[model samples]
Target chain A: MSDNVVPMKRTGEATPSLSPILSLTATAMNSVNQVILDRMQSEIPLIPALAGHLISGGGKRMRPMLTLAGAQVVGYQGTRHHKLAAAVEFIHTATLLHDDVVDGSETRRGKSAANIVFGNPATVLVGDFLFSRAFELMVEDGSLKVLKILSSASAVIAQGEVDQLTAQRRIETSEERYLDIVGAKTAALFAAASRIAAVVAEREDAAERALDDYGRNLGIAFQLVDDAIDYDTGTADMGKDRGDDFREGKMTLPVILAYARGDEEERRFWQDAIAGFRIDDADFAHAVALIRRHDCISATRERARHFAQRACDALSIFPDGAARRAMVEAAQFAVSRGY
Target chain B: MSDNVVPMKRTGEATPSLSPILSLTATAMNSVNQVILDRMQSEIPLIPALAGHLISGGGKRMRPMLTLAGAQVVGYQGTRHHKLAAAVEFIHTATLLHDDVVDGSETRRGKSAANIVFGNPATVLVGDFLFSRAFELMVEDGSLKVLKILSSASAVIAQGEVDQLTAQRRIETSEERYLDIVGAKTAALFAAASRIAAVVAEREDAAERALDDYGRNLGIAFQLVDDAIDYDTGTADMGKDRGDDFREGKMTLPVILAYARGDEEERRFWQDAIAGFRIDDADFAHAVALIRRHDCISATRERARHFAQRACDALSIFPDGAARRAMVEAAQFAVSRGY
Candidate 1:
């Protein structure tokens, strides 16, 4: 880690933690959790069956927590954010279901993916159900502005997914393109999830934009660390398989940076590996070695630190309080999470 | 055909036609088509490429036509329905793309399905893009009422689809249950698309309810005819493969009726076929033969005629004129389509 990186805390010896966030939003999150459980049920038994499989699994519920935390940061006292927070979680869950199907994932959150357990058809339909349910929750809130933000973010996410699919297996993908995909597919929802809190709080535009910035930067930093961990063989498995990105030919930041920094011989190996010619465990080991040789994993983490620092900075507008501090620590935790 | 069935028209010399509805909505449909083409585009090339493969395919834009025709029936002068109509079409297209993937179908609208032309990953992602885009369109129109109707309908449709999946391969499925599935998955969208026009028109509650009934019954009738056609060997291939329902073990109305009316030996045969133990062409032929002997195709179409007549009657509250006649005829056509 670099000295320029943001510290986990200004006064404590502890590492950055989500404990403050979890505690800060714990009571409100119960209401949000109730909304999620209530809305996910349907007369169609399979809809709830498939949705509950993933939702009841040990997901972090990070997106909805952002909504709740964002509300506290803005000093909003209303209960409106509870339902809205649940909507955010529903959207995130829907995205995960589709993502697992798209990636053909076997395990998620230390268990079989919904697609694996229910089969792809049921998984996809339940995802659609949850997505539509998200919109229903928003419409119940009756905020046109919130609807616009979330619906637009949803479109951007799909575009990013398609763009990433296009870039898959293409060895020549640039860091810029990878970052753009991360911004859309991951950060857009995070941004929306945080921003909606400001809207419900009746906060000024400045506060809204600040929350958006906080979530977006934190999301990018989070994704960068995730991509780094895929190649970090030293780390324990984090829910998903370690080399999923490698086997799927995802042009993640570490892969992009490694290819950029490689010699002619190393470049040849990357081309073969990224083009789906190399996917064995030995190939993954070699890929990780190449990434480590170029110090790309640390490089990726360094970039994550920059974003995490910005995420903390974006909270400066709010008064120095536990809520803002918790969010800031959460952002730091996002980057330093695996390592 | 039964003696009590609804005739093609009040007068002889022509079968019921979509021509009236088509011509009535023709000019406004151009605008909807433009919106669909423009909005479906993305920086990700594969999105529009995959979407267009299905969009530009020669399928009739039936649902959007409902919106436009409903607008005409209610004398809605504003052009807002144009965008809403496109939104309906986008939802329908998204469903079709997912349906093809779920069914593992090889063709749609007589061309290769988007899933077949593009891979399933791209197809599913493009479907997501279109669905999100549909919401974006609705949000842009800034009508919470319209959003509520469509979003609620979407949730119901997903529930219905999951229900149908649950019903698949279970030969004991009842006609009442099948009808319920059709009402949710097919008729709900129809109801929403037509009702939104009245909402945008700022019409009375009665008018809105009338439009909903018109659309819902019409949708049910449309689905009944489609299900009947799958068993109709005398019918020309209607863009989809004949006996797909049989092979997929879907217990449509024809199968339900044939099974109910069947003797012990025939019941055993259906049990084997619907359980996927029999899937060859000869098995499908036997299934169709049993259906024909039991006169179940006509029975299914007879149910379609009842719904179509109800659909036509729902429009009776509107003034007697071209729009009303066209809608009525469209309902008639829905029931008689595959015959």
Candidate 2:
């Protein structure tokens, strides 16, 4: 490990921020964004139109930033990761497009979902176009290693999605199973995205594993926080239609925790609501009250905080500087969203 | 070209059949089936369950058979094409799953479609899993050439699907546009599957291009005959729900031909039907009558015969032998399916 100083958050600082990582990756992201825009185009007008709707949407580009930052942390000077990073974003966007269709989502990133604007058939097909384009990009890069990572992660994501569908209105879904789904559907891509950075930089296996662990834990934290914000009612910057999970009868962590701790009466209410019996505004209000009473949101964020810290700690083996500090702070910022 | 004899169809013999190709590819296809069964397995039970619904639904494994037969034509002795053939089938199966979802298909291969049995969410996600698995298999094969062919074909297939969707309700969809969509969505994969056989054999580019032409023409004939069968009252062994294109407003060649040949009153009926107004059994029956009056189904089959002949001619450069004869017979069988 290098003998450079690792920056820590100031004692009693106002809040953790994402600016460090944002500025650190700003220049690199422009190249990645160009690749993304160029690659998403196709002869079919609908392919580019629907893909652009989501690509231009205000996503954080958080996953690719991990790749860029991890590259910086390893002192790599090559520009190949720009295309790789764009491929990562394409994979992510493809999943999001499919997710909206599966969920019958009304809005995404605070706008009408692609499925809504373009219809599900076009949406699904465009998602496929983007996915195939992702592989094409990886093939052009000629990295069997990256192809394996991304392809395996993609399968895991789809499997996780199916698993989540199986667990969807069951009401008996365990936190373990929920976490498994989170790891597969959400964190698998995260881990792959971060791990590819080390591979592109030609770093050691230890560095790759370190970045994988960091990304996986950070992804879990990020998903947990998103789940928390869904029911928090205090978060006004909702990027999707609120109460969508509740209406769709998704067995997320908040519901799982609340149900695990509910009394017989409260349990009956949850059982009814989760079984698709109660879904009006009043029912959602009651569900929110039950969750807040059990402090499940806080418990969920507490879990997120644990993973975010683990993400930061994963960076310690690398040289400490702006790159390391930015990545560490980005982890903190991931958990701080919707606060 | 070797001095081997190319078998021509015997005059005064029985109709051309798929038996030659079936016998030619039977052994190798068993190995390909093994790979497909092995790879389609996943930790998520729903994936295999849903995927198996379509895989075992008794549809002929026509695309992979093309790969195996093309390998024989090229005299490839290796077992690598088995995995690659399975990869081709996986891509085909993935697209079928997504197509059923997109078209809201109720029956596939004369049984309940996967979406009908397993729900759309699982169907879509499993399709994604299988698609990723296809890429994984190709990556394991470690041929960048094969990857490029398959990936580019996949992108074209997706684009074709989107193009077809855009043309769905437009009664003015011309024969040219319909052919373009069919080429991309169906023939592209067929071409890729056949070409990969030459790629793995390390054959000359001439052999690859010839095989590609063979597959592409056969695929067009296959799909054209399928569209013809949908409207032909004389045909019995329909694979999917009849009139699905009619009900869903898909602009296939049959519809385009009938519309093009219709009178003013007939044209209005066609327009209304294509625009989703006329969809009852009576309307479908009347539509069939009008199509028959125009001899659209026969015209469509004439078109198919032209392509099938081209498919057979494309294989002429190869030595005429059992492999060549089997593939040529397979093309004839493809166009003769619903007769």
lDDT of 1 by residue, A1-339 (tens): 433343445765588889999999999989999999999999988888899999999888999999999999999999988888888888889889988888999999999999999999988888888999999999999999999999999999888898999999999999999999999999999999999999999999999999999999999999999999989989877786799999999999999999999999999999999999999999999999999999999999999989988888888888877898799889879887888
Model 2 lDDT, residue B284, Cα: 93
Best candidate according to DockQ: 2
lDDT, each prediction:
0.91, 0.90
Among these predictions, the greatest lDDT belongs to 1
Candidate 1 lDDT over residue span B24-92, tens digit each: 999999999999999988888888889889899878898999999999999999999999999999999
Candidate 1, superposed: residue stretches over 4 Å from native: A1-12, B1-8, B11-13
Per-model fnat list: 0.77, 0.87
* Candidate 2 per-residue lDDT over residues A47-114, each given as its tens digit: 87899999898899999998898889888899999999999999899899999889889899999999
* Model 1 CAPRI quality: high
- Model 2 per-residue lDDT tens digits across residues B150-199: 99999999999999999998999999999999999999999999999999
